[model samples]
Every structure is written in structure tokens, then in C-alpha cells.
Target: MATMQECPRSPEAKLGMRVEDLWDIQEAQLSPTEKLNACFESIPVSAFPLPSSNQEVEIKSDATLSEAVKILAHHNILSAPVVNVDAPEDASWIDRYIGIVEFAGIVVWILHQSEPASPKSPSTPTSATAIAAAANGNTFALELEALGLGSASTTSGNFFEDLTSSELYKNTKVRDISGTFRWAPFLALERSNSFLTMLLLLSKYKMKSVPVVDLGAGRIDNIITQAAVIHMVAECAGLQWFENWGTKKLSDVGLPLVSPKQIIKVYEDEPVLQAFKVMRKEKVGGVPVIKSGSNTPVGNISLRDVQFLLTAPEIYHDYRAITVKDFMTAVSSYLEKNKTAFSMSCEFVTCKMDCTVKELIQLLDREKIHRVYVVDNNGDLEGLISLRDIISRLVDEPRGYFGDFFDGVLPLPANSRV
Candidate 1:
């Protein structure tokens, strides 16, 4: 009776019994996928970045490649929808919406430019009219690179020397690379589409961001991202589910999820372009750099590292001769030289196969990275996990969440960085 007379409560506990009852009701939902989807729909499209009246982030098709890079870096955006300036005055707003210029697309342009000019088939000078036509054709090829719609080469030569030497990277118009919305196609989703529909579209298309078109409103209103999906699942799904999933070792997590054909890795001594090629072909953001003749991971490279090329054009000037080491070293040097002035770390995050999945997610959240490389007992490369992989798994294996609560505790509280 005396103990029951007084009890202390923390600030969060200060809420009335009704509040706790409401939380219990919300958490009682047993269908994880349905609960996750409901949570996603509850979030407005505006939760992520949306175009403003100024639309300052939109890239103009007429802008130069250099300008496009600057805009992306300056705004900390990975891609932007290319808007057509030359659309017929009377054209519908949707018609002016062209393809997107992703940072990965810029990597393609860089790799292409780094290649030595293939010896042009010997040709004679032509009439001015004919020269103009050929110039237009060349422009079309450059535009293809701009749209990130080129294939990797089996031939061992640089393919972009002509484009670079002509000062096209610095002067070529973005519209030329915008390609047609018909060729590359502006894949869009409606604002009213279900959360499952958006997730399916992202997974099927392997897109980082898909524009949400409010057609009835006649506007490309907002965007949905893999990150958004991850966040929703993490928040709505019970913490017990995350803890249970996290307790499983990474080896079990990655190997079963990634097929052999999906594994993309590069060697330490290989040309950086090789890694970029793998990224482009596989549509991955990063690749583990390993030792030759072995899977032992030595380092990793990502599109974030590629962005450095835009800042230091000189390093890219020797793009063809530079190996992956040279590029990594340059990035290290740049970061080291500026570390005193900026809060940045160049270290690549890696995890052993024995580590728990929760540990991997914690590292991803802590480092603000998209993917983490999984290594074997010998420190050899094993597999990788990305935000997309996590989101896809949640949708495909919602039943995985039905299990006993984990007694193991997290080293740190979950912070939804991704």
C-alpha cells in the first residue's frame, strides 16, 4: 500500500493510458506486408522532395554536361528529369517531360570520354550541309551517353575520345542527350497508385526514383524512392521483426537473395572503367574491389566516388590511363587535403559473413551508405546487400516477420538514415 502511494514516470510515460492503448491497437496488426503498405500510403508523396514553384532542381535539356553535373552536386541530387525547352509552344506539359539524367549516366559519359578515340574510319572532308548532318548524328550518340543508355564494350579501347576532345562534355547541350522520351521513355507512376504498385514498379524497373505523375492535375508532382520503402517498413513493422531478421548472419542473408549472375565485382589493378562498366551493365551503384585471382575484398568503389571527377576535371583528363587505384588514390588525396576543412571520411564499409544482418543495417545507417559488401571467413568477397534488396525482401517475404521476439539487443538504437 505504501509503495503504490507514489511512482515516478518518465516524460514519454507521462502520456495517458488511452495513448498506450492506441499504440497497442496499431501494433496488433499481424499481416506485416499489409501493415507496411498501409503505413506507406499514410505518408504523403510530399514526404520526399517535390518540385517547387521555382523548379530550380529541374535540368534544362539545353544545359551543358558540366552544368548538369554541377546542378546535381550542388543540390545533392542523384538525378533530375530533363525538361525540354524547345517543346512546341502549344505542346502539352507532359510532352515536355523528357528522360532523366542520373549520376550513373554521368559515369557513362566519363568512361566514354576516357576511352581513346577509336581510329575514325578514313573519311574525306564534305560540304557544309553534309558536315552539319554528320555533326547532328555525332550529337545523337553523345546524347545517348547523357541518358545513360549505352552498352559496355568488349573491345579494349576507349570509345569517348572524340566526344571529349571536341569539348562536348563542357559544351554539349543536355537536350541532345535527353534522347527521346519515346526511346528511353519517361517511366512514371501516378500519385494515386498503391504502395505495392510503386514498390513493384521500382523493383521491376530497377529505378532509384520514379516520377509520380498526377495526370488529372497535369503535373509531375513528386517522386517515390527505395529509401522511402525501407523507411516505411522499418517504422511500421514491429521492432521485434527487425530484431529477428537482424539476428540471422549476413552469409545466410546475402547468398540466398543474390543470384550468381547478379554478383558484380572488380579487381584492384583493373582499370577503373571496368568497375564502371560493371556498375552500368548491372545497374548497381557500387562494386567491391578485390585482389586478382581471389575474392578477398581490398576496397570498394561507388557512384559517389565517381562524382569527384566533376570537381577535379584534371584527374579525368588522364581518365584512360588511370587504373582504379589511381582514381581511389586521387579521391583519398583530395579528401585528405580537405579533411581539415570538411567533416568527411573516405573509408569504405565492409562486413564479415559472420556478422548479423542487424549489424549490417546498423552500419548502413551509421555510414549513410546504400550497400555493404559481405566477406568470407578469409576476408574474401561473398555477397552484398542494398536498400533495394531489403525493401524487396520485405515485400516478397512478409511472412518472415512472423516469429518469436528476439532477446538480443541492438548496439545502438535504430536511426532510419536510409
Candidate 2:
């Protein structure tokens, strides 16, 4: 693991520094105070405009299951914000932000509602069997425009209507509702850090695109995606050693800023099922929720969390009967009980803000953990690092050649003997 050192502040020492000046300047390179002040700063949101609201797709809360599906499909969306059709336009119906109904939710509902006796014989199919089979087909292929229940037959309507037409059109009342899903509490970095530090931090965090904030003005600047980081690093490496030997701050590079509103979010108290639904529908990794209007983030729920809950029989059973409060484990609890009470192998990993990327990677690899919480010296979470961050950086890179020589046989040049 890399060691931390203090930075030199003497003006005479830094006046005409060169790349070689940094080789023995480990103390100055790793000082948290120096790096923190130099590398980390907040960018304002105004620079990056908030994402425009998605065009609302209105659906009656009581619409037939088929109608709901049609609306989702027609809009080419994964979920449609629901509303009460009978309510007046200015009724402040915002309180009625009833949870979104997503394709995943619909699938789960259908799977649960399916009768066990309907398909005992695999060879001999029944009406329920056919419906199940069709619904189980490539869900991704179903056009986004063909998601709502209203246009069931026009796309997959015959399958839905044939199975549950009577219950859908007659018993379900269509209410008016409209809304879009969002993810939030996103962190953006400025271009002041070295390509190496950016690579290290990004690999540690498992982020796709980190929004860049302008430290000077405290506003969103641009975005630094995994691709951007890799390209920048590759370019830096190609420079002569004299040109690229020293550490570079984040701002030295030119990364644009992104706004907080561009991030998606959900309430902390929301059902985990709803989180899963939105993730599936929007095709995002996770959602960040605030503790209310405060900028302090409560917690983030990701697709991996949902998958873990679903795959664990005990967890899934408990989830069916319990609320989010019942399952949520406070982050503080994990830190307080580290190593002694909580076995490193089975438990999550965490680190302080001062931890280096090399240290984080070793810990993650050794413990086989997916993510680690980054805390301050006081142990309060500052951010999170995950395998996704590492993998994202490697996405477009070419694989090395070690695998081709696994047998220990070496290929000789065309004109030479083995």
C-alpha cells in the first residue's frame, strides 16, 4: 500500500520544480491537508442546468392492468408516473406521488398471482401457461413505447387481454397521475487531480461518469466519464517522463461540470421494491436519497442490493412481510463493530478519507467485497468505492497477452528456431 506524507510549503523549494523534483517529494505528494485543499472543492449547480422534466404520461390510478401496460409501452418508458384522472389540475396532487408502477413490478405481480395448478404438465399447456410464457419472453425486446397496459393487444395485448380482460377493464378504475423517476446526491470532482489520482479514485469508487464541479465558483462544470479518465491517462502516459512525472491536481485537466439535479434520487423510507422497479425501468445503477431537503445523503440503494435481497430466501421472505426500516442496517453500526464482532470475510469493508487507492484495492481483493465506505478521520461516510468503478475503467481497454502463453511455450520469430 502507498504511504502518506506531509507536503512542503517552502516557497524556495517549489519555485523552479521539475518532474524529478516530485520523485523524492513523497511527503508533499501525499499530505491530506495539501491534497484536500488542492484537489477537493465544491462546484456550483447553476453551471449545469437541471435536466428538463420528462414529458408526463398520465394514467388513471385504477386503470386496468392491461391499460397500464399499454401506457408504459406507448410512451416507450419503463414506468409511468400515476395520477388520479378525476382530480382537478391545480389540486396540489403532488402528495399523491404514489409509487411508480414499473415493468419489473408488473412482472413480479404476475408471477405471484399465477395459479400453481395451471401448469402441471410442461408438454400440455393451458391459458395461464401461454400467458406466462409470453410474458416471460424477451422483456427487453418489448418496445419502450409498448409498455403501458392500455395498448396491450396492439403489441402484446392479445396475451394480456385473453388472460385477464374482464378483471382489467371492468374492476380497475383509471385515476390521473404523472411523474418521472430520478437519481441524486451525486458527487462531481474538478480537474485538479493527477491522471493517476483520478484513475485510482475512480477505480476505487466504481462510478460511470463523475460530474466535474468548478472549485473556484462552486458550480457544476462538466462530466468525467470512465472513458474520459482512461483516454486522459493513456495520453499522459505517452508523454516523455520529464513531461509527466509529477502529480497533477484535478483542475489542471479540463473536465466539464454536471448538476446535482442530473442525479436521480428516491426517499430513504421508500420501499426497496420501488427502488428496484425504478432501477430496472430507468436502466441506472443506483438511487441516492437525501434525509429530506438537506444535502446530507441518507443512503444509496443499488441494483446489487435488490438482487442480494431477492436471491436470499430468508431475506426475500422477510422483505415480503417487512418494511425498509426492518432491514436497513445503519452504516455507523458496521463501523463500530468492525473486524472483532463483524468478520471481515462476511461483512462489508470501510475506510477513512485518508485511505489510498492502493490500500483500498488490496482490502477489497482480500476481503472479496464489492464496495467500501469512505469515511472522514471521524468515521463518517464521505463517499463509497466499489468494484464497478474498477471494471468501468477497464471496459474498453485491450486485454493483456498472459492468457495466450499459459502453457509455458514461447513462440519464436519466423526466422529463428525455438
Candidate 3:
């Protein structure tokens, strides 16, 4: 049988190579030939399959907000697909992929819809009626239904025609951390700044992340986070102080830094399926997309985006050819149009350099963004804050699993170093 060393590097090459060719290769050094069949059998395409979306409840874009909420609540689904029944001629009718409507979005909308039209005087009753009166004449169920269906149902049954005529895509200021670029500003120690101080800032502002830049260097250095600080403190106290005494620097106790090479970029015009395949194969959560000419990041496509897409298979098939440009919300469009990014008003938060790691973690937890960006004073891109980075710093190795294994292990002879 072929030994481990006899395995071929390429399956295709193995299929074409003769048994004599394998036996003749000195590097393989196969003493037995029976194992060759076993290695070759493992090379089929079944070894890899495309990643797929997890089964979750789906809702039509035109469904009433009340209906959407009910479905989501019942199914425990966090988001749903919004479909445009009447898509363009080039588009497939069944392919009605619209953006997602998340539970958070629904909650925010409900809060706004339920608010009273006028402020109640001290004498106003605190009962349901008083509360309903204050809601500026907006009804939660009605508004939900209205927004759910788009405008066509109101004027006529031709919802797609009306939607198409009036810019089916609405620009809204969805919260994006990339916007709040700032340079490294000195945060005074007198501000009672500590890891906790920074943590509070992040949480209060609902930021996904904050950057730490060295003022003197004029470049981003390292990010600090609540998770990192906590883990470092725990490791110092638990390991170095009591067990392993010589390890120094946070890096020794934390996960290795992820180099930029680890990050993958995709074009905005690529098919969603292609992006989906890459992410699944790589086991990555998100990818940055750059415009055709600009190296600057235009937007991000994430797992959540795929989840929204899967809710409507028809839309997915139709837009399989669509690029990121077809759906991406531009920064300029966001600032000028009074439109929310992609028609949603998500909060955008950022922090200046010199912010502590503790602060960044708080922002991540509160904002619920998977990643955050660090920027310069002019809002130029600097670095990024990611959940993996935080977790790596925070996770601890269990104690005593290899106890005494390293105690007094013999040092190698000076001249006999292997």
C-alpha cells in the first residue's frame, strides 16, 4: 500500500498518472501499492459542496409590518426578504430578491409609529389612550402594512410599476462606521481614562469599533477592546503570576494577529453566488467590495446579506448577474439625498484614535455590528475592528491540561540542535 508520502498533490494529475509513474517517483517511496487506490478514491467533488443558507422564516417585502412581525416572532427569524413582484424585463419575475427587513428595523419603526403626535401635558393621563394620542397620528399596524406593500397597492394593483417609476431603491442613512473618520487625538489621562472609561464611551455611542492611532507616528497602531483588556488581566494573574513566569507581551498570551493577506476583497459587480461560495469555502463572515476603479472600500457584503437573499430564491436567480453596484448604497448618495442607506436609518458611529480597546468592545456589543472601521481625521480609511480579533484576545486556555509536561525538559546539547 502507498504510504502517506506517496499521496499525490493534485487529484487531476493522480487520475492521469499511471501506477508505474507513481512507483517510479522517489519522493513517494511507496513500499506497498494497495494504498494507492484509497488515496485516489478520496479526490471526488463530493469532498466540497457550496455553502447554503440555514432554513429560516421568509416574508414578502409587500407584507404588512404587523404580518412580518407576527411571522418573524412565530418562527424566531430575525429578518425577512422584501420582494418586488414586478421586476424589470431582464429580471426574472420569480427572482424577487429585495433587501432584508430585520427585527431591529421593525422595532425601530414600531417605536416611531407608536409615538404620540403631541407632547402630553402634566394633566394628561398616562393610560393607553393618552399614549396613542401622542403618536403623531401614525398607526403602527397601518404604517407597517403601508411600508410592507410599497406604494403600488394604494394607487392600483400594479405595485411594481409604481415602485419602478419612483426609484424602487431608496437611499437611507444606515449606520456605517466607515463614515466617522478621525485622526489620532490625545485623550487626556485627566479625563479619568482607563480601559473601563473607553468601554463606556463605546457602549453609550453604540459604535461597532474605535481605532487607536499613535499621535506621534501619524498612523494607526493597535486596537484595544474590553475583551482584550479583560483577558490580559486574567492571563497575567492566572498564568504568569502563578504558573508560567517568563511569558511577556499580550501577544504571547493572545491569538496571533491576522495579517491583511487574510482578508479577501470582491468586486461589487460579482454575482452573490460567487461571493457566497468564497465565503463558505473560506469560513469567513464578511468580505469588502471595492468599486471598479477605486481601491477604497465601497461597501461590505456579509452573511446577513446572503440570508436576506435566500429568503427569495426567485430574486436570487434573477439577480445572479447583478453586481454590487446594482444594490450598493453610495456614501455621497447617503449624505445628499436625506435618504437612509438602502432606505434604512441605521445608526452610524465612529471614534477617534487613542481610544482604548475596552471602549471599542463596548461599542461592538451595543451597536451589534460585526466589524468597525478606524479612520483618519479627514475620514480616510485606517484599519478595522473585527469580532474575531476581540475573541482571540479574550479566550483563555484551560489550565493543567499539559501539567508538568514541560517541567525540567532536557535542554538540547549546544552542538546537537536539530
Candidate 4:
């Protein structure tokens, strides 16, 4: 909401006063949120991951699914726009966007296709059976030194070979698995909208990123992601902001409350496909595992675990038959080989229910993750928190508590740059 007048003017116009002095004078006129929003809006979309003209990363609908995964991995992205270059000559500009392709969508499509024409039910245990199995102490116990703790299984080497050599994956088109954005209303932001508005959109929809549209041309301008938002707050804001936010507990800051019934989870004995079912249904990146008869969380599995598909296509060939435990171990083995700090056992970062907002932010920043599970004093999973949830809640705080920073302040013009 800041205007040119609110920014530091040139030295010639300020006479003997320095630009720093003028900036401080103008900065005093806005609230903390507005000042932060102005700081964010000042940044350009091109500086981050703008995919409009990039050919290497941007994909067409006809590209093979394997090709798509390779591109995403090469660029280190989770999704991208599925552009349609062969639009009808008579088609309107708005109809040209087509849809989006995400890793989750690809997983869903592949799983759907992997089903047998007359599928045999997987030996996945039901909730009751799983609990019984756990009580019998027959459940797989993780050991730090064993293959179960994320070490790649020496027995599964053939699994990868079978997958990459399969004809099913080689001929499958990316378009077949891509989700139509129109179904979700294709959430797009105007290039002119403030970064605060962008944050609200992503948080409201639980999206990792949203496309920025050049509304006039009906074309995507860029994609803004949660990572970009974190970058803005961390690099643009000063230490005073963090200290100020630290004093407040997470409960006071309006994160969605966590309840046992609402927590999406998987049994330790279930087929790995069940975990994917939970993720597809809930649109979540991960799910916690709970032992039968216990309220305490034991482990977690996520889409990141599925990234092994890009390198070890064999993982996909056996994914439907693979148990969640087996998949986690394979991913762990892969990460160890790549020298990443994460372990399937160590990746489930958690915080106590009473932790401060500042504490949550710090953990996320240090780990470079999007969320943390909030647990009670007894170590029971209570809720989940994400970077987007934190940013949205902070920005949406009631303005009454800040007194009248908006008083006597003129609204910035609609076309204002900064």
C-alpha cells in the first residue's frame, strides 16, 4: 500500500536531508504489515522462478511422463504449467492456458494405470488387522544400523530395472496424467496484486504456488511459490520483525487447529498405495504413521520420498506392491548416497503445542521445509503448521490493535508501482 511519496526521494529533491532519513520518515507512517507488503511488492517476479519463456523447464502436453519428471528434477521443481501450443485458430486467448502438471498428478495417473485389469487386492492390512499385528510385536521395528532404517535393500535392485525397461512408462504422455486447472478454477494472481494478496491465495487453497497472470494478455507472467515468500520475509525484513513475532505463541496467531479425527495418517502395515491415496484425497505432501493402541506418532512418509522415481524408475515398477516401509527405506538409501541430511526416520520434524511462532519459523528456516507437526506435551500429534499458514495469519491480523497507522494515510493509486 506504499506509494512513490512514501519511498525515499532523490537527494536533489530532499536538499540537505539524506534518503535514509527520508525513508525512515515515510516508513513511520505505515503499519508493520503494510511496510512488509510494500517491501515484498517491490520485488520482481522474474527474479524468482518465472517459467513463461524458459524452454528447458517448461513442458508441452505431448512430452512423455518420464521426460516431464526429468525436467522437474533437472530444474529442482515440483510442478509447472502444461502449455498448449497448438490452440485452435478460432480459440479465445483465455482458453489457451490448458492446465497444470504436478508430481502428485503424475503419481495418481501412474497408479491408476498400474492397476490390473482384474486386480488382486493387495495384502495391505486393515486398521484392525494392523493394530493386531502391532500388538503381536510382528510389526517391522526400525533399526538405525539395518536396511529398514532407510538403507537401500540389496534385494530390490531388479525392481528398478523392471520399471525403466517397461513399455508402459515409455509411451505414456504427460497430458494423460496432468490435472486440468479449470477444475480448481485455475487460481491465478494479477501481476499488479500485492504480495500480501498472493500469500492469501496460496494459504487459502493450500497450494505450493500459484501462477501470476498478465490479465490483459491472458497469459501467465510467472509462478510465485512458498519458497519465494520465505525468501521475501527472510531477506527483506530485519531482525526486529523476527523478535517481535517471537513473543507470540502459535495458538494466538491463528494456525488451523489440529484434532485427532482430522489428522490424515497411514498404518505401518498398509500397502504404500494407501499412503498415496491419503495424499491424493487430502492434497497433503505427507502423512504420519501411528501404532495401534497408541496415540503417539511413530513416523511420517511424504512425496519427497517418491522423488526416487526420477532416478530409480525401478521404484515405480514395484510401487503398487511395495510396502510403505520398503519405500521409505529405499528413499533413505537414495538420500544417503546423495549426501543429503535427511533420513526417513529423521525427516518427521515436530514441535510442542506450546512452541512460539518464532520458534516454528526458525525450525522451518533451518531445515528448509514447508511444515512441522505440532505435538502435545505427551508427544501426541495435535496439528500441522506450514510457512504459508504462518504468513497468512500474521498478515490477516486485526488492524485495531495497531492503533491508527492508516489514519490520514492516502490509499496508493491502483497503477502505482511500489
Candidate 5:
């Protein structure tokens, strides 16, 4: 969270290096950023370095949510490309895959199942404070009835049990939940595609990982992820161009594009289930946590955090009494005790409003996190930033900079975020 003093940024400061200069300037005379842009434009996906030995885990289409969670947790990845379980030998690349399954998708499915189908059906269950309320002999429910703040007709009793033990969790396959998340695109990057296209796919299109499928071989070579992109940026530490832009304070870059009021956060006292629901509905990877009645952030929780409930239910004694605060405390202690590298970012990651982009980059790379919160002098939350925010700042308009990057791809749905 090391930061610079708050300062004003010139209104006319350039958003990105000029693209035309990349094409016209002599290689020796070009500025570092201009040269870097040209280099990225010329490099194809095929030229990117090989994935680490432990990476590239894929989930079969038939894998149940339970099985998928184990695979991801076992590999410690956030998402996996799902191969077609019944594809013929000569199938097209698209035909050979159903879609990528993500931790976020599973959470969405579990939340959907908790919806009360009918008045006669069991009430939708809850976790953290909701479950704690239920555990107290329905006293909260009775009080709600007396106060008219809640009613038996709406979400009355324990609606969802332990998430992993729920019927839907055991029975549902990865294929069955394809429609659960609004942003689950199965797009694959071709070997011939440019690096800028990959960046835009990850940053602009909100792709968590772009599967690199070799159509000629009909096999995946590697998955390009935001972490990989950040790692590359981190490696450019000594480069003059990176330092030029990276040295600028976050205020100069202006990311986390949304204002404080636009942020989707959960109070520590609220039910943890509500945190997951709002995250799914809002299409955010992680949600920030605010101390009740205060702007300060106590922690940050991600959709991927559910791996605990999925793979290691033993971590929490009473899953029902787990409030968002309790969830954070248990997770932080567990990670520290075991020192597992499973998103050390989820516990408590915050920064000052004037943190340098370079500082943010190193923090994310070191902590293995996707997002970080920005707080004020009082450590009160100001905004939440992510890998996407950093990459998005690298270019002005991706669509215009990378010509025809979307050619022959399926058209984006009209409702997609522009």
C-alpha cells in the first residue's frame, strides 16, 4: 500500500502512445512505449512463452460441480476449459468443447437453486448471519414477524444447507450450468492472433482466460490469463517505457473506472451468501468488504473463495454461523497456518488512493491476487481495482488499435458490456 501524495493529473494527458508513430518511426528513434506497442502488435499468440508445468488443467464436460471443484482446487486454478465428453474424433474445435467452467459459475448455480420454487417448497437457506439467525430457534424470524420486516411467505426457514452437500451441487454437471453466468464466453484465441488481441480479450471483453486452440491440431496449447499478462508487465520493470507509465500514481492513470458508490461491497455483519449473490448478479470476480457503518475495508472476498466450502468443508466448524467477517477470519488464519498459495489476495488486500501502478503490479504478482482495494488516509475504502483495470489502461481503444481482431468470431450478444 505504499503510495504517493495526492496530485492533479493534466486533463489532456494522453491515454496511450500514438499507434501511427509505431508504424512510421525508425526502430532506433522510437520511444519505448511506441516500440513496445509495435512489438506487441507484431507478436502472435504462438510466440508467447509456454505455460508453467502445473498449468493448463482442463475439466471434462461430464464432471459434476463437486468433481470440477476438486479438479480446480487440486490444481489451484480459477477456471478450466471443458472438453466435449461425447465429441466425435473429427469434430471442429468449437464442437470439441462445451464451454469453460468457472468458480463463479458454480456459485451462480448454487444461488439459483436456493430460489424458492413455490410457497410449499422449503425456504431458501442462507449462510453467515442468516444461518446464525435460523440457528437461534427462529427467534429472529418471530421478531421479524412481529416487526413486519420479514414474513414466512418470503425466505422463511433454512433454505439452503451446506453448499457442498446440497442436492443440486452433487447432481449438476459443468454442462448443465453453461447458462448460469451472463459472461461465460467459450472463445478461443488462435495461434496467429496478435498479443494486443489477447490483452483486449482479457481486459475489454472480460475473458478470465482465453483458450489457445490449434485448429489444425484441434488441441489447446495454453490458456492466456490476466495473471500471465501481469507477470509479463512485471518482467518489464527496468524498461524505460514501463517505468514511464508505471511510475505514474494511480490518480494519473484513473482506473477502477467506477466511483465509490458504484462499487458492489458487502458489510462484515451481512450473510456471506449475500456476498456471493451480489457478485454473481453484478458479474464481478470479487467483492470488497466494508466495516459496518464505516467506509474502511476489512477484507476482500472473491467468487473463487468458495473453493473452501467446495473442497474443504472442515475449515469452518459451523458453516451455518459463518458471517462474511467469520468467513474472512477463518480463511485468513487457514491460509497463514498452511501457507497455501491459493489466492492469498482474498484475505485483506488494500492500497492507498495514490499508489503507483507499478507498485500495484508488483503487489498483485507477489500476492497472487486479481483485485485490490484503494482506501483513503483513514484506510476507508475508495475503490477496488483489478488486473483488468491495469491492462485496460495500456491502450486507448482496443477495437480501433487492433484491426479486425474479432473477425470470423461469433458476434457478441447485444446486452454485452461495451
Candidate 6:
């Protein structure tokens, strides 16, 4: 584990010399990974591609959860900033936005709304035959519009309509769930902040996305995501520094940070709701679906995959009874039928332990996936690697590189997920 290092003030500290200068002088003495880190540190947030507009998909604080889902889907975003409608035009960006409401957070909310008063397992058998039969009439594929790949069928979604507490999603406002566990604190990066600072926040701090706020203009100029960072790293494929580090095998980099016993996964026989609840509790974006009574990974389920469940008609017919097997079967069936609409995410990316870092990066970038599972010769999942995990290994925050830069930021809870 890396700790924040303290650098005592020297006469040079009073000279207003930024760490980037010190880094440049020491660049020759640095390792491949450190050189790559310094390369990014030299860049500024302004260098990133700016969005068309900050107001592109701004959701009102008063908007219903259902309305929020529609807006996110329409814009093909996993999350959007929830701004305070009553904030004065002169209010600071901090006061203007409540927090980013994400697809994952909303999935947890749906699971909460569907919770039964008396907990009991459904009688439906989770066998393959049963699940296959249930998926027959389904026309929905793993709609990944949240990534702007394409549009999903505007099917008459029955997720909200099927819920007994239908009004929960229909009437509940986005602000009402501010107290939920998944509600992340609204933290933004200034355009002048170093790329290293943003990298630390995304990896070490576990922030899925960091909103880049332009204080001078008082608008969110861009939202830097882990995916964006991964893409940036991918673009450095031929660079000497990235090539030196990327050639190392996964084992050398200590990836799949967790052991097989530590992997959090769900069985195919378990209810689809249970799989989501497990993801919510674990604070993970996704989990591999294991075959019933075995360790074989049959499929992958993620929070973003909720679009298929919510938008698909047959999938949500029995929210409580739908098994992970049924869900995976439905996704496979739908994607096979509507191949173009289905993104590469419909299939999980897997690699052996001997896979090189560059190979892993290629898998993630080419597939546009946030994670990849490491499997054995027999194809049984041994561990997992996420975009966050990959970036965390690439750089180590230097001592005093950022002196009290994030001091006044809101304290994130131990279990906060974004």
C-alpha cells in the first residue's frame, strides 16, 4: 500500500518551484514507470478534449428517478451531474450541483424498491432449460448506449411498472436518495490541476469519474473518466516508457490484485436480484457469473448491464424470480439476434496469467471494457483486473507532489461507491 509522503520545507520550497521542475531534472534517474508518470504530470487538464457543452445532459435535482434514467439512456451516459435547480446563477459550482447520480446507484435503488417484506426464495428452478424457455420471447440485447455505441430498442419497459411500489421510481426525486450509500461526494478538478492529481483520484481514491470544472467560466468543461485515462495510456503504445512497462507480464505487475478466494462472484442459480445486491454491497462495478456448482465463469454481469433488464420487457416480468442464468441467457440471445446493437461488452474479456500488460491494455481498450478476468488453462476464473487496478500499478504519487491540494474536499465515506 502507498502512503502520502511528507516533504519538509526547504529554502527552495519558498521559491514557488512546482514539483514538475524537480521531476524534469530527475527524469533521467527515474524508472520506466516513473518516466511515464512524469510525462503525464507535465500535461494539464486543459489538454483533454472538451465536451460539446456542459449543459448537454444536465439533470434537475427535482427530476424523478425514471426521468433521470431516460435522460442518461438518451445521452448514452452511465451517469450525469445532478444540479440544484434553485441555486442562484451566481452560486459556485459546488453549490450548483448536488452529486453525480450513476446507473449503479440507481440499480441499487431498484433492488431496494423490489425488496420483499418477507424474504423467501422463488420456487422457479434456475436450471438452463427453465432459463432458456424464459428468454425465448425476449428481444432486448445488452443495450450499451451508455457508451454512445448505439441506440437500444425503446421497448415498453416494465421495470418501474412491474414493481409493486411503482411510485418509488416514478415519484421519488433524485435528491431524495442523497443519503444512500452509493451517493458519491461531488468532487471536481480545476483545469490547471496536474494530470497526476487526476490519476491519483481516479485510481487510488477509487473515483469512477472525476468532473473537470472550469472555475473561471464556472462550467463543467469536461468529465475525465477512468475509461478516458485507459484510452490515453493505450495511445502511448509505441512510446519507449509505456513499451518498457507494458512488456512486463501481468504476474510481474502484481495484477488481479486479489486471490481466487478473494474474488466476489455470484452463481448462475442465484436470483438476478441477488447478483445486483452483491455488487451493491461489494462496491464493485461488476462481477463474473459462475456456473452453478462450479467455479467456471459462464458470463459477466455489471451495474451498467441494468439497461437490458430495465428496458427489456420479458426480463423484468418477474423481477424477484429472474435468475442470473436467465439474465445471461437473455443477454446472449438478444445480442445474437440484434448483433449490431450489441456492443463488444456482451462478451467478457479473459486472459491467462502470462498475458502481458500491453496485451491486457489492448483487450480493455479494444473492447471498451472497464475490467478483464484472468482465467486458468481450463478457463476457470482465477482473479480479475479492472481499469482502476491497471492504472494504480502504473504510477506512484510522489512525495509532496500535491501539497494539501485536496485538503478542503468533502470526506468520502469508507464504503462510498461512484
Best by lDDT: 6
Clashes of each: 5, 62, 39, 1, 5, 0
TM-score of each: 0.67, 0.31, 0.33, 0.67, 0.78, 0.78
Instruction: List where candidate 6 sits over 4 angstroms from the true fold.
Output: 1-26, 51-55, 113-161, 316-320, 336-344, 412-418
Tens digit of lDDT per residue, candidate 6, span 204-252?
9888888888897676778988887777666555444566688999989
| Tens digits of per-residue lDDT for model 3, 305-342 | 53233222233233323455543443223324543323
Q: Residue 391 of candidate 5: its Cα lDDT?
A: 88
Query: In candidate 6, how many Å is residue 6 off?
Result: 42
| Cα deviation of 385, candidate 6, in Å | 0.7
Candidate 4 structure quality by residue, lDDT tens digits, 1-418: 1232344232222221222232344477787566555544553343344433354246777888778777776666667777666776445434665566766566555443322223243332233334323432432211111212121222244444544444444656765443422223455666665554566566654667777777666667778777656544443222344445555788777664546678888866666656776676577777887765777777778765555654565544544346666667666666666654332233668897678776676677666677788888888878877777777765553334324523543344332111
Report the error of model 2 at residue 387, Å: 5.5
| Each model's lDDT | 0.56, 0.39, 0.38, 0.56, 0.67, 0.69
Model 5, 1-418: lDDT tens per residue? 0111122121111112222233345388765445665656766777666665535677888888889988887777777778888999988888887777777667665455433434564344332225324433333333323322222122211322344665446766777666445433467888998777787778877777778889898878888888888876775554446677899999888776767898988899877767776777687878888899988788888888876656656666555456788778877777777666564555477888778999999999888888888888888777878999898887544336756746666554442321
The candidate with the higher TM-score, 3 or 6, is: 6
List where candidate 4 sits over 4 angstroms from the true fold. 1-56, 88-96, 113-164, 178-184, 214-219, 236-242, 291-293, 314-321, 340-346, 397-418
Q: Which segments of candidate 1 are over 4 A away from where they belong? A: 1-31, 34-56, 88-93, 109-166, 180-183, 214-217, 228-256, 259-262, 315-320, 336-346, 397-418
- Where does model 3 exceed 4 Å of error? 1-256, 312-320, 329-353, 375-383, 400-418
User: What local lDDT does model 2 show for residue 322?
Assistant: 29
lDDT of 5: 0.67
Clashes of 6: 0
Task: Report the C-alpha displacement of residue 180, candidate 2, in angstroms.
Answer: 23
Ranking by lDDT: 6, 5, 4, 1, 2, 3
Task: Name the weakest run of 10 consecutive residues (lDDT summed) in model 5.
Answer: 4-13
Cand. 1 Cα-lDDT: 0.56
> What's the lDDT for residue 82 in model 2?
52
